[model samples]
Target: MDIHAWQLWILAAIIAGSLEMALPGFVMLWFCVGAVVASLAAAVGLDINVQLALFTLISVTLFAASRTLFKKAFMRNASTVKTGVEAMVGQEAVVTESLVEGYGGTVRINGELWSARPLGGPVAEGERVIVEQVEGLKLWVRRPAASLEVPLKKKEGR
Candidate 1:
């Protein structure tokens, strides 16, 4: 029982397209395109070796071309609908605990408790701070410069 070259090429195309669904990002799409091209070559009576070489060349070229174009398109259409830690940036939250240098503290953002750090000063408990950045599950924070005040209790005690 021998399978025709056309049948092999069609099978490759179907498998490539199916794999695209399981592992998306347009990676397998170029292979599927190549397989289709190979199938057409087979229909035109091209030898199997030529068909294979053509498939490899076409797939590589298409993948490179699509990757460049996709990146450009993706960048142009990007949006900031924050999800996860990204959403915490620019949000205001009260320091639930003091953030000592080299130590972690906690803050509540969007009703969720998160590990936080003061940018460059001790953030006393109940001090309002704005999230400057998020690294992993931790939030970097600072008192908005305009709202900063000297701590009277600390100054008097020193």
Candidate 2:
């Protein structure tokens, strides 16, 4: 009726796995793998202290290895495509309201009027601007260079 060391190590692994699911940090699961290695050490009749040391070494090494894998699997790459409003950057927009330095205005980008601010000097209404950044519900814009500007035809009345 005596519980064996390997059985205890296996139980610890199961507990670690369950805790990983409940907390979900993508961290504790590495310890579960270490516990499995410890169970193998115990099955071979290794000393308790030796099993503990092996567990610690296995867990830390696996964690380090996983970080590189995670970077390749989850992190952005140079060829990655952006979606949503993030896709608006570098696009051209029209100022719907004049933007004074340090003050906010409105711009129409992709057919939507968004609160906007200029990165440098003020932008006048109906002027063309380029989207520089998108922060929260606001936009950061800049005037297109002179070479990029197209002269607007004047209305007969004004």
Candidate 3:
């Protein structure tokens, strides 16, 4: 039985492709493409050195060229994609329990109760607070700023 160079290249390509599926980042796909190209070169009776050079050149060139495109396409909106606790920031919640100074209480947000600590003075029960930050299982909160409250206007004549 004779083992061929193209067979090894194809195996490498398959392994790289599998790795791309298992990994969390955009890599290994370029190497898989390069391996496939190297296998094609071997099928055309190209020298092993030439096949290796082609594989390295193709992989590196694709990796470098795609980096900027990947960043622009995927990372451009990264800041806008907030999830979990990060999305809780700036959200309004009703205090479920009086939050005493130097003591934490609970608040309800999004129909869920969360441990909350006041950012400044005490927050009374039923008061609306804005989530300022999240630390572990607790949320730092503050009374809604005056700007967020709408002032009632008096009638000119009653």
> Sorted by TM-score, highest first, which candidate order results?
3, 2, 1
What is the clash count for each candidate, in the order shown?
0, 0, 0
* Candidate 2 runs further than 4 Å off: 74-88, 97-124, 132-158
Q: What is the TM-score of each candidate against the true structure?
A: 0.51, 0.58, 0.60
Q: Across residues 1-158, which tens digit of lDDT does each residue of candidate 1 receive?
A: 98888889999999999999999589998999999999999989999899999999999999989968887877778775878777778989988888877896998888888899889888888888999998988899998778466667656666
lDDT computed for candidate 3: 0.94
Q: List the residue pairs that clash in candidate 1.
A: none
lDDT of 1 at 80: 54
**How does model 1 score by TM-score?**
0.51
Model 1 regions more than 4 Å off: 1-32, 39-45, 63-65, 80-83, 98-106, 114-125, 133-140, 147-158
Worst 10 residues of 1 by lDDT: 147-156
lDDT of each: 0.89, 0.92, 0.94
TM-score, model 2 to reference:
0.58
By the lDDT metric, which is better: model 1 or model 3? 3
